[model samples]
Target: MSVLSAAKKVFYLPIMIGEWDMATIVETVAAMRVLVAEARQAGKSIGFVPTMGALHAGHLALMQQAKKNCDIVVVSIFVNPTQFGPNEDFTAYPRTWAEDLAVCRSAGVDAVFHPPARELYPDGWGTWVEVTGVTDKLCGRSRPTHFRGVATVVTKLFNIVQPDQAFFGQKDAQQVIVLRKMVRDLNMVPEIVMVPIVRDEDGLAKSSRNAYLSSEQRQAALVLSQGLAKAREMAAAGEQEPAAIREAVLSHIQSAPQANVDYVELYSFPDLAEIAVLNQDVLLAVAVRFGATRLIDNIILTPSRT
Candidate 1:
């Protein structure tokens, strides 16, 4: 077997292997392709965890989960420009390649796929992948082309990495739903796993963007999770009306001094269509601004007759 294949088998053994940084080897598509081919030949079923760099505990959690399920884990750190609008924070988005590599290395990630923009999108690239209906709600309504960019970049990553399974955080509930739908509709063969939202001790959902928040804004940001928790509590206490559950969440966030709601929505899970009642599985999602940072959080409410 080739050296690359042997490395994958050793790195991805069922035992918890120490994190290894493969970002240094990910300078080009040609190199990644060869590495992937070798890993596949070694009987390593690939698992992918894609991120926009600035890795955090939440991202690490997802990577660790992927490591458990697949023989090889590939993590991609590219902040796709196509997903960020002109007025958005793309220019200001965090990039800590060195630190991010450390986090991935600690998570036992076998490979870190860090592709540059020009290489992924080439000059004069015009093709875009858009998902209808779902992108028109919550964060999508405010950020417009956001989900399209996510779908496109994710599709491209899936094609390039060709993993047997992929992992995403539940923090971006809408994103998780959109990707799952895209994979199904397009007949992509990877198993999409939606891991639970990872949060701070104070309940703030961990995100790379959270780095942008000032000390005060950081405290104010907890409202998003507070809203989600309120919704969960109300639902468990016998609230079944979607509007009531949504309002319970919204009111908490709106009460915060720094919170400005972009959108606070309740939608059906996986499908993400609007639901008038909370009698089925649903996601209570919100996107709000604290200072200049836009953060999102959600809670999944399974239906109950109580």
Candidate 2:
């Protein structure tokens, strides 16, 4: 099937063609499916970016990357409760619907799936999708139930939208790994596209939860990135031992008065196996808590042999 060009204009009559400001926003699964079906019938390639509300530059960059590849782009803004732990910030998570829609519109998103939790979960929801191995480390060790919730909601969204491709940011490195494993193991069809993490001028990863940071807490959050950079530098300088690299990261994070180090781990890429030597490409991940707020950052690095 020939794919429609990203620049090609389509008309539905009464509505103007080739307009980003006219992006459609739908809240129901039924409506979202109808729109996806119509796009497919038109020979348009669909790109999906699923996210919780409170749009940020990172989310917008993902949408922009989607628009560059697919003729029709769909973004979901559901703040999934299942992904949060009992004492976690499910109730406190930011949800800026109007601003999110504006960001989507500006990015030329064809549809916005802003479904309510009741509509998606309803009652008696029992089944969930989980990928093993990859989820057993990194963020999973700390937030045990997190990836289960993520996989379930992502599977539901994929089923509901059935897009040609899905976009995800690399900031959530383990998440991308788990979702990729889920797609392969479950035989799902949507092409998984991993976009690089967009960061602030000071190198802090852009996250919705960053809003919770006080001025001091915000400064303290930099320790996550700092620790990751230090570990990467050590790997480049021929530091092959995992224990030494981890210690470097922990010490830097612990130096910050407001920061509490969560975990500093090194693992082989994709496989996520713990590594002792810096002989190949690996993932360096760190998490730090700034008072009540928790922040995470990671970098994929290739060890520099001396």
Candidate 3:
């Protein structure tokens, strides 16, 4: 066996030795493949969590959930360029490789698949995957090609990682739904798991982009969460129209001077379709700009029996 393969064997031995305490951290695709092979040899099930580095508590929550369900947990930390538009902050996106490694290590991630962009998508990469309808609302309306980029990269990741199950935070509710649809439509085999959104004590959804916020912008950004809260309150207290729920959310954000509304949408939860009445599972998704930083948040409301 090669030294890389040998190292993987040693790293994964604890898993087969009936010790679930061991976690492996790898930074390249080759290392991840070797680790996955070793885990498979050990008859261990695999779970995957993919992210664009700058790991936060929200990411840790996804990793923890994966740890609970799969014997081998793999996390990928590649800032996929295809997912970012030309005008977007791809250049400024946070990337703390060493810090992210430390975070993954502490989270008990079995292997970290940190592949370079070229390896994942070669120079001749012309093919792209697009999911219609779901990408037509909220951030999609603004980003246009954004969901296509997301779908293409995610499909590539799914092909490369081949995890038996994948974990995504519900904080990106539309993303979760888009991926689920992609897997189903394409007949991909991995089971997709959605974890609840992790938030700060003040209710702002934890995100890597939160670092871009200035002290004042950080405070202004809380309007996204507060707006969602207001929508939930209005919906629960006998507001049944979808427009009413959306208006409530918009009104709250409009109250904040720094919050520039990008979109405040009321759509069918997970389907991304517009809803006339607020019945069953519906998503209240919003995107707003505080200074130059764009942030998103959503709340899924089920109709109240009352």
Q: How accurate locally, in lDDT, is each candidate?
A: 0.82, 0.84, 0.82
Off by over 4 Å in 2: 1-23
lDDT of 1 by residue, 158-245 (tens): 8888989999999988888888788888999988899998888999989998888999999988888877877888888878899887
TM-score of 3: 0.91
Using TM-score as the measure, the top candidate is 1
* TM-score per candidate, chains pooled: 0.92, 0.91, 0.91
Candidate 1 is scored at a TM of 0.92
Tell me the spans in candidate 3 whose CA falls farther than 4 Å from its real position.
Answer: 1-28
lDDT of 3 at 275: 80
User: In candidate 3, what are the lDDT values of residues 106-161, reduced to their tens digit?
Assistant: 78776777777777877888999999868887878888888898899888887767
Cα lDDT, model 2, residue 257: 92
Per lDDT, the best of the predicted structures is: 2
